[model samples]
Target: MPENPVDPPGLDLARLRAHLDRELPGTVQGPLDAELIEGGRSNLTYVLTDGTGRWVLRRPPLGHVLATAHDMGREHRVMTALGGTGVPVPGTLLLDPGTETLGAPWYLMDFVPGTAHRDAAPLAGLGAPRVHAIGERLVDTLAALHRIDPAAVGLADFGRPDGYLERQLRRWSTQLAASRSRELPGVDRLHGLLAARLPESPVPALVHGDYRLDNVLVDEHDAVAAVLDWEMSTLGDPLTDVGLLVMYTELAGVGGGIIPSAATAPGFPSAGELVARYAGLTGREAADLDWYVAFASFKLAVVAEGIHYRFRQGSTLGAGFERAGEIAPVLAEHGLTTLKER
Candidate 1:
């Protein structure tokens, strides 16, 4: 659990305790306490405890919502479907779809202990070798995730895998239109170029929409303890995942305080090396990577812009949000250039 977490804005402890008691009697003996999990902009996460037992809960942000951006059910369903698979997810305990409990839907799962590499500072003491191992383990885990068969896992109908990239572009474009607060240059141009150069996607796999190094928790032995944040998980093109990973690794140096990036850690594999490793392990052609990478940058630009919108409305709770507004243009320019180079 993160340190110094009060109820904050969205969580009400009294309602949470009463609901827990009603749902599962005697499971919670003492009074419940909760703290807001920091370092996230989309959903509101809380670490709940009853003296000894601890669980993590996820809910949507306080106000100004989008259509499919914060679907708690989608997150819970994907994580639940991935229970027995190689994908390391916490044991899901409960899910509430109604808003009567805590003003919105939320679910609970076991809290695994480890460090999530949001920035390079966490790996400063681990030396170069361990950091390299950590990087390898991250790619390995992504490959493992893509290998899972949705049919075998009872998730074949989770999403329409056909024309997934086109749908994705439309979806993100819709999201961007709804959240636009200021002038954004080149986003539409990048979108046009990406749509024009759409690649031939391979068999659909379990795509973690935001698969980056910081999204996974790493243990002391440099192993990925678990992959967190399933809010954006779906069945889609596997190269989309690879491209996003590459974009994050390559742009970690230039996020310029827009997004938190830990790819600068010593001995961490370069973006090209990581892409080759993924291709070698998965035995898949990585052609048309530039289009996908540009798409990733475009997607992240919209995400940062959304955060900036929330920040402007005073709905976001974090320090780094101030720079979010500036991130969209930088990423948009990068996306436009990436696609043009191809």
Candidate 2:
């Protein structure tokens, strides 16, 4: 904690301290100081410390939060459900469902210490073998997540898994419509192609809506410490997660600093290797991966558009938002190309 840490945007330290004392008593040891954790564009995450203990707090973004997005309760609930599973998650502490405390529903969890690598610099330093091992571990973790039965994990009712592909297209389309400020050239064509080429999803599994290298914390030993950001976890088409991973890996070169590209490191496995590894671990066919990748691109385009919309509206709280608008069109065009090639 700094000598006098100023309050970060979207979180009030005094109120948070008061709330914690009342709810969880004996949690805070000293003055509460907080700094918003960067790299998250959807939910606002803050690392708070009482100088003795540290915890992470997650809440909805400042404004323009779309319907069914940035649910603090959902994030907390899912992480809690996956606590004892093979899927590593931060230990959930408490949830404030009401908005009277921080002006939004928020939750607290034990802060796991590790690096969420967003760039390729550090990964490149690890040499090819270590980087390759990290990539393989990422895919293996994802496959492990897809192997978990939602019913056994108390997430059977988390989301409607039936017609997951069609519903995802419609959901993202709605999200795009909500944030449409300017025309994206290939968005319509990409969406239409994805809708037309919906793949037969594998058995419904607990899906980490945004599973990528950056969303997970990697320990010094090059193993995943905890999978953070459960804002989009649900029971749905597991391949959607794989598709998104592949898209992120492929876009590392052209991400233009918009997407996290730790996968771009010299030793990181290629997108093809990730897909093949996932198939082998989960025994799921990657026959229709093309469509899934295309859909992933479309979904990301909408997500970028949504973030761009929030940034334009002055609702975004961190840096790197200005470049978000540029990603949507790029991803839209890429989605179109993927579909065409398929």
Best by TM-score: 2
Query: Residue 89 of candidate 1: its Cα lDDT?
Result: 81
Clashes of each: 0, 0
| TM-scores, one per candidate | 0.96, 0.98
- What is the number of residue pairs that collide in model 2? 0
What tens digits encode model 2's per-residue C-alpha lDDT throughout 39-86?
A: 888998899888889999999998898988888899999999999889
State which candidate has the highest lDDT.
2
Q: Candidate 2: worst 10 consecutive residues by lDDT? A: 253-262
For 1-342, candidate 1 gives per-residue lDDT tens digits of 334335667888778878888887776777677878888878888888888788899999877788888888888888888887888888787888999978888888889888888777777568888888888889999999999999988889888899999999999999999999888999999989888878888999989999987788888778888898888888999898898998888788575645656788788899888988998889987889998899999999999889989988988876688888887898999888877776
C-alpha lDDT of residue 293 in model 2 = 88
Question: What are the candidates' C-alpha RMSDs?
Answer: 2.0, 1.0
Tell me the lDDT of candidate 1.
0.85
